[model samples]
Target chain A: MKLAYAIPAAGIAALTSAYASAETITIATVNNNDMVIMQELSDRFEEEHPDIELDWVVLEENVLRQRVTNDIATEGGQFDVMTIGTYEAPMWGERGWLEPLDDLPEDYQVDDLIKPVRDGLSHDGVLQALPFYAESSMMYYRTDLFEEHGIEMPDQPTWSEVRDWAEQLHDPDNDLAGICLRGKPGWGENMAFVSTLVNTFGGRWFDEDWNPELNSEEWQTAIEFYVELLGEYGPPGASSNGFNENQALFSSGKCAMWVDATSAAGRIYNPDESSVADDLGFAPAPVAETPKGSHWLWSWALAIPATSESKEAAKTFITWATSQEYVELVGEEEGWTSVPPGTRESTYANEKYQEAAPFADFVLNAIREADPTDSTLEPNPYLGVQFVGIPEFQSIGTQVGQQIAAALTGDRSVEDALNAVQRSVERDMERAGYLD
Target chain B: MSAVQTKRPWVGVLAWVIALIIFFPILWMVLTGFKTEADAIASPSLFFTPTLESYVEVQGRADYPKHAFNSITISLASTLLALLIAIPSAYAMAFLPTKRTKATLLWMLSTKMLPPVGVLMPIYLLSRDLGLLDTRTGLTIVYTMMNLPIVVWMLYTFFKDLPRDILEAGRMDGANTFQEVTLLLLPLSMPGIASTGLLSIILSWNEAFWSLNLTASKAAPLTAYIASFSSPEGLFWAKLSAASTMAIAPILIFGWMTQKQMVRGLTFGAVK
Candidate 1:
C-alpha cells in the first residue's frame, strides 16, 4: 500500500514538472544564413527568459511561405512567430491575421529601422513585422576585365550602354561571358529582375485602373533588349540560370558582369568563396527612360500571428532577435561582414560595418531610393517594386515569367511571348475579379 | 554450349553498361559530397583533393540522430499499421466476391488521383483542432492513410494468385477464417507480405509534403531535415549533397537487404 501511494505521488510530480513552469513558443523561419545565426544564438534568449522555452521550425523559403500562410489563414496556431517577407506582411496584416507590433520595448529602437524597409512591412502606418535583413538589387562587375578591355562603366549605366559593353567584352573563345542574369521561370526567379527592367523602361503592370499593361510598347522594348542581350553574350544554357547559378558563374570568373541582389556582396567579397573577389566592382542597377524602380526593395522580416497563445513571449523573442544588441553580437561572433544589412540605419552608420562592407553605402542608397508605391513612371495600383501586392499576382507573375523565359530560350519570339503574357494576365485578373 | 558461352560474355558487358548508367547519379552525389562548395559547381573535374568538411559541417549544423529516429519510427509504424489494415481487406476482396467489390476498389484508388494540396487546408485544420499537429502519432496516421490504397491493391493481387484449393482444404479440416489466415495463408504468402511492407516503408520514408506541412521540430523526418539546407540565397551543393547522402544511406541499406524478397514476390505469379 505504501508503494502504490508513492507511485501515484511520483506520477503527479512528473506531470506537473512537464507542464506547469514555462511557456513554450514555436518559431517557424526560413533556412537562411541570418536566420541560422539567430537560431544558433537563441540560447541567449532562453537563458535570459527562464520562464519561457523556444522551439524552432526551420524550413526552405517556398515551403516556409506555404506552411506559414496556411497556418495563419486557417488559424491553426501552429507557429507563434513566423518569418515572412515584405510581400506577405502588409497583405496579411491588412487582413487582420498578424498582431500589430505597436508596443515594443523602449530599447528596441523601432525608429532606427530604415524608413523604406520599415514602411514596406507596415499596413497603413502600423508595423506588422520587424525587418531582420533587407536588400536591393545592384550591378557587380569585374574591374580587372574592364581595365583589360579599356571599358569604363558609368556610375548609373543605361540598358543600351550595358548592352554595348556586353557586345565589346563578350569573349566566348576564352570561356568568359559578358553577363550573367536570371533566366529561370518563376515569379521570384527571372520575373524579379524582369519587373525592374519593365519599370526602368517606363512600363507598369497595371494602369490607374486595374488592367495589365504587359503588351505595352515599353514592356516590349524592355523584354526585347533583355532577351537579345542575354542571348548574344550570356553563357550557354543561360535559360536555366537563377540567382544562385548566376552567382556561381560570376564568382568563378566565368562572367564579366552579374546584376543581382546586394546581399551577394558578402559571398562575392569573401576570398574563400570567389576567385575574382579581389577584382570586383559595384554600380547601381542600370536604367533607360527612368530610375524610379531601377532597383528592387525586399526584406525578410519576422511577425507574430494573431493566433499565437504565447504572443507576449513571442514578441519578446522577436524584439531580442532584431535588436541592435543582436547585431553587435553577430558582428562580434561572426565578423562584421556577416552582419545582417539594410535593416538598421545604425548598421550602415557604424564605422566598422562600413569598413568591412565596401558596398554598404551603395546598397543603403539603392534601398532608400526604391519607392514601391511610385515605382513606375505612370500611375499604378501595385505596392511592390519587383512584385505585385495582390494575392492573385503570384500565379499571374509566374505565368508571365514562363513566357519571358521562353522568349530567352528562342522557343518563341518576343512579340509572341508578350502577347501570350497579356492574354494570360487578363484572364487571371478577370478570374480574380480584379478586372470588371 | 559453346554458342551460349560466347553470348553470355557480350550480355554481361551490356548488363554492366546499363547498370552503370542507372547508378551514375548516385555515384556523382557521393563524390560531390566530398568536394568543396566551389569545386562542386566549378567545371567538373576528377582531380580535386577530396575533403570531409561538408560532412563535418552538415553534422555540426543538424541533429541527424533525432531526424533518423523520427524517420525510422514513423515509417515502421505506418508500414505495420498499413499491413494490419490491408491484409484483411485484401483477403475479403480476393476470396469473397461481391457485385460492388470491384467498384469499391476502384473508388479507393480514385481518392489518390486528387492532389494532396487540394485537401491540404481541410486536413491541416482538422489536425490542428484534434491537437494532432507536430506529433509522431499524427505523421504515422497520415502515412498509413496515404499508403493504404497501394498496400491493399498489391496485397489483393498477391492474394488473388493464391490457390483457393488450399484454403478450402483448410476449411474442410475444421479451421475457421482466423485460424486459416494465421496458419495457412500467412506462411505461404510471407514473401508477398514482406515486399508490400517494404514498399510502404520506403514510400513513407521519402514522403516530404505532409511531413513538411504537418510536423514541426519534434516529429520532423529526414525529408524535412534535407529541406532545411535549402536557403533562399542559394543551395550549398556540397553540404546539400552530404546531407542527402546521410539521409539516403539507411534506406538504401534496408532496400538492399530486402531486394531478393521483393524480386521474388513481384515476379511470383508472372512466370505461371
Candidate 2:
C-alpha cells in the first residue's frame, strides 16, 4: 500500500509541475511565404516541447513593424518573438531593444550562417537576430528568348551592354518587353533596386559628414540611365510594377528579363509556378563604374525583444526555425523547391537541395559577396548597401523615389527632380541634425 | 406627379448604374476568390473555371470561426455598451439643454479628429497595466470608446427631432421619469435607435486599427485574419480575396437580411 501510494503521488507531482510550467509565448510575424511555412511546421516544435504553447500574430509587413515597434518601445511585453528584417534588427539591437542572441547551443553551428547575413543582423559584434531567409539582388533572363534572338549572354554584363541588348530584345508588338524593374515608389520598392544602381554607378546617399549627394554627377547619370532605359523598353505602366508585378509578368512570359531579388528564383524555378521556369537564366546584377554594392542585401530574421517574459522559449523557437535540421524538415515535407533560401551553407551543400535548385550556388555567392559595411566606391557613414539604415531613411528614400517617378512621368525634368530631391534630402538631414 | 412619373424610369436605370458601380469592387473580390493565384494576376476577366482551392486553403490555414466569433461578439457587445451609455446622455442633452451643451458636444466630436496613432502608446500601456492586453474585454472597451461620440451625436439628433410633448404627457399621466423616458422616448424613436445601433455595429465591425493594436492571437478579429493573407514579398491575391470574402460575409448577410428595416431606419430623418 505504501509503495503504490508513493508511486502515484510522484506521478501526480510530475504531471502537475509540467502543466504549471507551460509557457504561452506570443510570436509576432509578417505574413511572408517563409513565415507561413514556419507557422505550418511549428507543430513539430510543439511536439518536441509540449510544455510551451504558441500564439501567433501574423500581420502585414508595415502593420507588424508598427505593432512590434510600439510594443518594444513601450516595453508592453505583448510579444515574446518578433519577426524583423535586417533593416530593423541592427537598428533595434543598437538601441538595446532586443536581447543578444549570441549564445545559441553548439548543435546550431551559428558559424554555418552566411557571413553577410550574420553581420547584417548584428550590432557591436553580437548577434541579435537569426536569419530565417536572406536574399541578394540578381539578374534573371529568358534563355529561350536570348537563343531565339541569337544573342550571346555574358556572365557579367555592364549597363551599356544591357541597354544595347535591351534594344535588340525590345518587342512591344509581340507583347514582350525588353526588361522589367521595380518602379513603385517606396524605400524598399524602387529605391532598393535604384540604390543598387546608384551604388554601382559610384554614387552614395551621403558623403563624409552626412552631406546629401543627390546633386552629384553619379546620381544624375544613374537616374537618367534608369529613366531612359525603362521609358524606351519597359512595359506600359512600368511605374506601378514592383517585385510581385514583375514576377507575374516574367512568369506569364510577358517579359524577357527581370532584375530583382534572388528570393524569386525558387518561385521562378518551380515549373508549377512559372511557365518559363525551364528557360530561365541568371547573372549578377549589372555594373557600371564599380562592382562594390552592385547587389543589395536583405534578410527577414527572427528576434526576441528585451521585454519578453519568456525569453528562453522565444530563443528556442527562433533557433529551431532557422536550424539546418529545420531546413531538412521543410525540404522533406514542403519539397526542396519551397525551402527557405540564402541563409545556410549546409543548405547549399545538401544534395537534394542542390538537385532541386540549380541556381543554388549562384544565389549563395551573390548573398555572400554582398558587403553592407563597405558597399560604395566612396567612403560613407551609413551601414547599408541599398539604404542609409536610419529611421529617417524610410521617409527620405520614399520621397526621393517619388521624385524619380515624377521625372519618369515627365511631371518634372530630370534636373528639376534631382534638384528637388537634393533640397528635400538636405532639409531632412538638417532636421535630423546630421548637418549644420 | 406627371413629371415624377416621367423621371421614375430614368431614375431606376440611374440607380442601378450607381449601385452596380458601387458593388463592382466587392463582386470582383468574390470572383477573384475562386481563381488560382496565376489566374488572379493574369488580367481582370469574368470567364474562368471557378475553383475552391483558395477558399479551402485560407480556411484550412486560419482559425476562421474564432476570428468570426471575436468580430461578432466585439461588435455587438461594443454597440450594446455604447447604446447603454449614449442613450441616457443623449436624452439628457436633447430634453434638457444647458449653457455648455454645444461645447460639450463639440469636445466629444473632437476626440474623433485626433488620429488613433496619437493615443496608441498610452492606451497600449494602459491595456498592459490593466492586464487586459489581447483580451476580448479590453477590445470591447476600446471599441465602445471608439464609437461613443458618433452614437451620442446620432441619438441626440434623433431625440431632438421628437416632440417633447409625448414625454411630458407621459409624465402628466403619473408615470415616473425613468418610465416616461423608456416607455415613451425609446418606442416612439425605435427606428432611429435601431439605425444608430446598426450603424454603430457596422462601424465597430469594420474598425481595424484598434482591433489590430489591442488584440493579438486570442481575441484577434477578422481584420487581423484578412491582414494575415497579404504579403509584401509574395503573391497572395487569391488567398487574400478569399479571406476577405469570408471576413465580410457575416455583416454582409446581416445587412442583406435586414435590408427593409435598414432602408427605412437609414432614411428615417432624411425626408423630414
Candidate 3:
C-alpha cells in the first residue's frame, strides 16, 4: 500500500509543475491610457484568479499593429491576447487568426456593451474582440480663449465657419496657433485627419466601382483647403506633427481649436495631464457639403489569438480587463475623466461618470452617431471612416499621405499631389484585381 | 602669432556658436523631458512650467529595468560572440595576405548595403522556425550576424597596425599557434577590441526594427520601449523625450567612461 501511494504521489507532483507552467498567459497590447490602467490594476486580477499569471507586451500604435500582424500571420504564438483595433478585428477574424469570443461569462453583460462599438469589433455577428475604449472624432476648443476673444462657437459649426473663427483667433505673437492638426505621413497619422476632412468635403477614396478618385475636383479642394488652413494658422514644423504632438499643442492652451478623437477628451480634461483641463469646450467635428461622415469611428479592442496555448487564461484576463468592474475601478483610482470611455453604455449612463466628466455627453453622442457603413458622401467599398479597411491600405494610404505632406511643405502643388495619388492608388487597385 | 591671433576673438566666438548649433537638438530633447507634454510641443522654447509628470508616467508605463536588462544582455552577448568569430577571420585576412582576402572583405562589407527590409521576411521565418523569435539568445545571434563584418574589418585594421616582428618572436618562443594568437594578438589589439565592443553594444542597443519585430514581451529592448511613447495622431514630445533619456542614459555613461579606449581605437594607425 505504501509503494502504490508513493508512486501516485510522485505522479501528482509531476503534474503540478506542468500545470504551473500552463497558467501563464502573454498579452500584446498598445500603450493607450486604458491599457496602462489595466497594467497597473492587474494585481487585483491576479489575486482574484491566482491560478493565472499575466504577461504584457505593450507597444506603440504602429509598432503594435506590425508586431501583432507578424505574430498572427506567422502563428508564432508569442502572445495570447492581442490589442487590435476595429480595423484588424474583422480582417484578422476573417483570416481565422483570432478566436471567436462569443461565449463570454454571463456576468460580463455582453448585451450592455454599446451596440455600435460591439458590432464594429465583430465579424458575421460573432464577437471577435472586447472594446477597451471606442471613439469618434470631435472638436475640442479652448472655452477660455473663445470667451476672451468674444467668439461664440456653435455646437454644430460648419467647416467654413470654423476656418473663419480660426483666422479671427490667430495670434502667432502670443505663441498661440489658431489650430493644431496631424501632419505626420502615415496611414493612421495625418491620413486619419485628412480622410475625415475628405469625407466632409464630399470626397471619397474610391467610387462604387473601386476606381480611385484622388484627383477629382472635390479631393483637390480638400487638399488645398487643408494646406491653406495649416500654412496660415498651424504651429511651426507642422509637417512633422502627429497626434501626440498635436495633443501637446492643444493641451498647453497654445491651440485655439483641435479636431481629433473623442478618446482624447479624458486626457485633455485630466488636471494632472492637461493645463487647460477646466477650460475645454467640446463640439461635433465640422463639416462642409456633408455632415454624414464628418467624424470617424474607432475602437481599440482586445482579442485572443487562435494559436494561443493558454487560451483559457488569456480569455479570463481579457474579460477582466473589459469588464464593467474594471471601468469603475479606473474611475475610483484614476478619476472618472480618465476612465475608459465610449465602450459600454453603462459608462455613459452612470451619474457618477456624467457628473465627473463634462465632455461625457458630447463624446457619447459623437460615438453613437458615427456610421462606418456610410462614411463618405459618395458610395465606396471600404469599411473604415479614417482608413480604408484592407491589407493593402497600409501601403496605399501611406503613399497618399506622403503626397499630402509634400503639398504641406510646398514641395509639390495640391493638384500634382492629388494627381500622383490618383494614379498610384488606381494602379494598385487594378493590380490587386479590385478593379477589372 | 601675436597680432593675427589677438585680433580674432570673434573666431573663438564663432567656434562656440558652431558647437552650440551642433548640440542644439540633443539639448532640446533633454530640456523637453522636464516639461509637461503640453508645454513641450506648444512653444519649443525654454519658457514653461517644468514638470516631472512625463518621467513619472514613463516609469509607470512599462518595466524600464526589464528592458534595460534585456538591452545589456543582448548587446554584450552579441558583441562577445561577434568578437570571437571575427578576430580569427580578421587575423587570417590581415596576417595570411591572400589575393582573395581583399575581395572577401569587400564582399562582407557589401552585405551591409542590402536594406534590412529586403531580407526581413526570410530572416523572420528562419527565426520563427528555429524557435528563436522574442528570445534574448535569438537576438544575440541575429545581432552577431548583423555586426560581424564591421567587427572583422575593424579588428583587421588594428591587427595589421601591430608589429609583425613581435608576433614572429612569440612564434619563435614556442608560444604555439593558440598562445601567440590569444596572448600576443588579443592584448595588443585591446584598444581596438574595446572600441569595437563599445560600438557593437551601442548599435545593438539602438536597433529598433529587429527588436520591435522579433521580441514581443520577453526580449524587448530600450528601442521598443522608447517607440511605445509615439502614437498615431500626434507625437508625445515630453513622454517620448523622457523615454529616450532613460533608454540612452546607460550607453551614454558607458561611452563617457570608455572614451579614452574608443578614441585610441578610432585614431588607431593614424599617427603612424
Candidate 4:
C-alpha cells in the first residue's frame, strides 16, 4: 500500500513539473509560401519535441512588418519568433531587436547558406536570422506565345529590346497583354519595379550627399519610358496590379512576359497551380543602359525577437523549420518541386531538385549575379537592391510610388510626378538630417 | 402626371438598368469567386474556364471556423453590452431630461469624430499594460466603445419618438418605475431596439482597422483572416476573391435571414 501511494505521488509530481516546464512560443510571420509550408510541416517537429508548442500569427506582408516592428521596437513581448527578411534583418539586428544565431548547432551547416544571402541577413559579423527562402529578380515569359508569334527572347535582353518585343506581342484585341509588372501604389509595389528601372537607367535614388534625385534626367527618362511602355501595352487597371496580380496575369497566359522575383517560378511552373506551367521560359531580368542593378535581391528569414520570453524554444523551432533536414523532408513529402529553394547551396546541388525544376538555372544565376552592396549605376550612399535602407524609405517610397502610379494612369505627367517626388523626398531628407 | 404615366415602361427599364449597374461590382465579385485568378482578372467577356481553386486555397490556408467564432463572439457581445448600457441612459435622457442632457449627448457624439488613429498609440500602450492586446474581451470592449455613440443616438431617437402617455398610464396603474419602463417603454420600442441592435452588430462585424491593429493572432476575426490572403508580391485575385467570399458569406446569410427584422427596425416607429 505504501509503495503504490509513493508511485502515484511520484507520477503526479513528474506530470506537474512537465506541465510547469511546457513552453508555448508565439511566432509572427508573413503569409508567404515557405512559411505556410513550415507551418504545415511543424507537427512533426512538435511530435519530436513535446516540451515546446507553437502559436502562429500569420499576417499580410505589410501588416506583419507593422506588427513585428511595433512589438520589437517597443519591447512589447508579444511574439517569440518573427519572420523578417533581407531588408529587416541587418537593420533590426544592428538595433538589437534580434538575437544573434551564430551559435546554431553543428548539423545546421551555418556556413552552407549562400554567402550573399547570409551576409545580407547578418549584422556586423553575426547571423541574426536563418533564411527560409532567398531570391533575385528574373524574367518569366510564355514560351508558347513566343513560338506562336515567332518572337525570340534573348538570354539577357536589354530594355530597348524588351520594349520592342512588348510592342510586337501586344494584342489588345486578342486580350493578350505583352508584359505584366507591379503598378500597385505601395513602396513594395510599383516602387519595387521602378527602383530597378531607376538603377538600370543610370539613376540613383540619392547622390553621395544624400540629395534627392528624383528630378534627375536619367530618372525622368526612366519614368517616361515606364509610363509609355505600361500605358500602351499593359492591361487595364494596371495601376492596381501588384506582384500577385501580375503573377495571376502571367500564369493565366495573358501576359507574354513578366520580370519579378525568381521565387515565383516554382508556383508558375507547378501544374497544380498555374495554367501556363509547361509553356513558360526564363531569362535574366531585362537591363537598360547598365546591367549593374537590373535585378533586386531578397530573402525571407526566420528570427527570434528580443521580446520573446521563450527564446530557446523559439530558436529551436526556427532551426528545425529552416534546417537542411526540413528541406529534405519537404522534398520527400511534397516532392522536390515544393522544397523551399535558394536558401541553401546543397538544395541546388540535389539532382532531384535540379531535374524537377526547369527554371533552376535562371533562379540560381539570378541569385548569384545580384550584388546588393553595389546595385546602382551611379554612386549612392545607400545599400539596398530594390529599396533605400532608411527609416524614412517607407513613407518616401510610398509617396513616390503613388506619383508613379498616377503618372501611369495619365492622372499626372511624369515630369510633375517626378517633381513632386523630388520635393517630398528633399523635405524628408532634411528632416532626417541627411540634407545638411 | 399623364406624361409621366405614359413613360412609365421606359422609366421601369431605366430603373432596372440602374439597379443592375449598381449591383454589378458585387455580382462580379461573386462570379470571380468561382473563377481561377487568371480568368477573374482577364479582360475578355465572361466565357472562360471557371475553377474552384481559389476557394480551396483560401479555406485550406486558414482556420475559417475559428475566425468566424471570434467574429460572432465580438460582434454579439459588443452589441449586447452596448444595448444594455444605452437603454437606461437613453431612457433617462428621453423621459427625464436635465439641463446638461443635450450637451452631454452632443459631446458624446463628437467623440466619434476624433480619428481612431489619433488615439491608437495611447490605447495600444494601455492595452499592452493591461495585458488585453489580443483577447476577445479587449476586442469586445473596443468594439463597444467604437459603436456606443451610434447605439445611444439610435436608442435616444426611438425613445423620444414614443409618447409619454404610455408610461404615465403605466404609473397610474400602480406599476413601479422599473416595471413601467421595462414593461411599457421597452415592449413598445421593440422595433427601434431591434433595428439599433442589428445595425450595431453589422457595424461591429465589419470593423477591420481596430481589430487588425490591436490583435495579432489569438483574437483575430474574419476580417483579419481575409486580409491574410493578400500577398506582398502580388494579388492572387482568385485566392483574394475566394477569401472575400468566405469572409462575407456568414454576414450575407445573416442579412438574408434577418431582412424583415432589419427593415422593420430601420423604419422603427418613425411614422407613428
Assess each model's interface with DockQ, reporting 2 decimals per model: 0.34, 0.33, 0.24, 0.21
List the pairs of residues colliding in candidate 4. A243-B233, A243-B234, A244-B234, A244-B235, A245-B235
Estimate the TM-score for candidate 3.
0.89
**lDDT string, candidate 4, A189-252, tens digits:** 8888899999999999998999989999999999999999888989888999988888878877
Model 1 reaches what TM-score against the true structure?
0.94
Residue A199 displacement (Å), model 1: 1.0
* Number of colliding residue pairs in model 3: 8
Q: How closely does chain A match the true chain A in each prediction, as TM-score?
A: 0.95, 0.94, 0.94, 0.94
lDDT of 2 by residue, B9-115 (tens): 78777889999999999999999999998788777899999999999989767877677767877888999999999999999999898998999999999999999
Off by over 4 Å in 3: A1-22, A144-151, B1-61, B169-176, B229-246
Compute fnat per model: 0.45, 0.51, 0.41, 0.34
lDDT (Cα, tens digit) per residue for candidate 1, span B1-272: 67876878887788899999999889888999999987887778877889999999888677676677778779989999999999999999999979999999999999899999898888898899999988889999999999999999998998999999999999999999999899988888888999898899999999999999999777888998898887766448888889999999888887887799989888878888
2 or 3, greater by DockQ:
2
TM-score of chain A of 4: 0.94
Candidate 3 recovers a fraction of native contacts equal to 0.41
Pick the DockQ winner.
Answer: 1
lDDT of each: 0.89, 0.89, 0.86, 0.85
Ranking by lDDT: 1, 2, 3, 4
Model 2 CA deviation exceeding 4 Å by range: A1-21, B1-7
lDDT of 1 by residue, A1-436 (tens): 2432443355345434545478989889988778888888888888899998877788888899888988888888888999999899999999999999987889999999999999999999999999999999999999999999898987788888888889988999998999899999998899999999999999999997899999999999999999999999999999899887898888889999889999999888988888899999999999999998889999999999999999999999999989899999999999998898999999999999999999999899999998878899998988999999999878888899999999999999999999998988898888888889
